[model samples]
Target chain A: MIARVVVVPRPQVADPQGITVARALAQLGFAEVRSVRVGKYLELELDGPPQDADRRIEEMCRKLLANPVIEDYHFSLEEATTQR
Target chain B: MIARVVVVPRPQVADPQGITVARALAQLGFAEVRSVRVGKYLELELDGPPQDADRRIEEMCRKLLANPVIEDYHFSLEEATTQR
Candidate 1:
């Protein structure tokens, strides 16, 4: 199974990194650029059936993969669909 | 523009967290699971023309959004395609 996870700042949170990048983009001639929010993307593959994968992964995310207080995480579970 | 970035453990890196999740999935009856790799995914929205957006965002990624030695990042620039 493969899991693609994304951890992003909640909309209300302050994202200084994103703001800083946005400023740089403007300086680099991307004058129309408005905002930039940085976040994390993760993909995991495990040998398993789908039945309980979501629940387990959700738990894993909350416990260590993501910080619930400031971030929001999302993921997808599937059979290995593509080869790298 | 929305840039979706993913930061993943290098293929050669040992990801103990991925391993732990894989074990849990197996225990939860995802018996067919084989291996799992975890990575990051980010979406950024910047109002801009397409011409210089990529280069600027790429730079932002390397400087702060991603750690090149241990991870890889990817993103896209487009007019807000889907509203969330």
Candidate 2:
């Protein structure tokens, strides 16, 4: 099974990296850029049945993959016959 | 307007970080994990109309936000009333 997780900074939190990048973009001539927030994307392939993937992913996020306080994670599952 | 860009390692690239992470997960008891890949997520808000955003974001990706060779980027555009 394949699981994809998208983790992003919480809307209310301060994102200094985003601010820095936004400033750079403005200097690079993208003056319309108002804001930028940076985050993480994770893709995982697993050896288990599709049924067990969601629960496992939730546990993974809670245990290690994501910071519960400052980030939010969402995941999607798909069955794959082989690794690409 | 808002643009969310997802940048991920190309499938053909060697992702040593992912390998290391997967190994750590196995040691932490996630034995079902076959592989892991990590990437970047960027959220941007702009001051322009939706019509100009797509081309501008593509240029942003090409010129600064993403490396054309080892990484692939995809972005979504939406109209936003205000920053949250």
Candidate 3:
């Protein structure tokens, strides 16, 4: 299975990286940009049955992939295929 | 408008961070893990009409959001709503 995870900072949390990106965009002439939030996107290839993938991925997010105190994570699993 | 951008390293590129995460997951007892790839996700809030948003976002990605030599990026735009 292939698990795609997205981890984002909680809305109330301040994101300096996002702020910097927004400022940089403005400087680059993208004045339409008002705000930006940066996050992590991970793709994990797992060799396992789909039945337990959700639980396992959830645990992985909580223990390693995401900082529970400040971030929230969600993932979707799809059957792995031979081609990219 | 709101744009969600996903920037990922090209497949041929080496991702040390992803390898480290996979190793850590294994240490944490997630043995089913086969491989991992890490990427960046950015959410941008824009104050403009949706018509020209795609062109502007493409330019932003080419100029600032992604490294053309090493990364590939794609984005989706949606109408911004008042509520979260």
> Which residue pairs show collisions in model 3?
none
RMSD of 2: 1.9
Q: How many backbone clashes does candidate 3 have?
A: 0
lDDT of 2 by residue, A1-84 (tens): 989898888999899989988999999999999789999888999997788889999999988889989999899999886766
- DockQ of every candidate structure: 0.47, 0.87, 0.93
Which candidate would rank higher by lDDT, 1 or 2?
Answer: 2
Point to the candidate with the largest TM-score.
3
What C-alpha RMSD separates each model from the true structure?
Answer: 4.6, 1.9, 1.7
What lDDT tens digits, residue by residue, belong to model 2 across residues B20-69?
87988898899999899998889998897788999999999999899989
Write the candidate numbers in order of decreasing lDDT: 3, 2, 1
Task: Give the per-residue lDDT digits (tens) of candidate 3, residues A1-84.
Answer: 999999999999999999999999999888999999999999999987889999999999999999999998889999888744
lDDT of 1 by residue, B1-84 (tens): 666666778889888877886787577655655776766555667665667678867876787667899877677666676655
Give the interface RMSD of each candidate. Answer: 3.4, 0.9, 0.6
| Model 1 ranges off by over 4 Å | A81-84, B13-40, B50-71, B81-84
Provide the lowest-lDDT 10-residue window in model 3 chain B: B75-84
Candidates ranked by DockQ: 3, 2, 1
Question: A29-62, model 1: which lDDT tens digit per residue?
Answer: 6666567667766676655457877987787678
Candidates in order have lDDT scores of 0.72, 0.90, 0.94
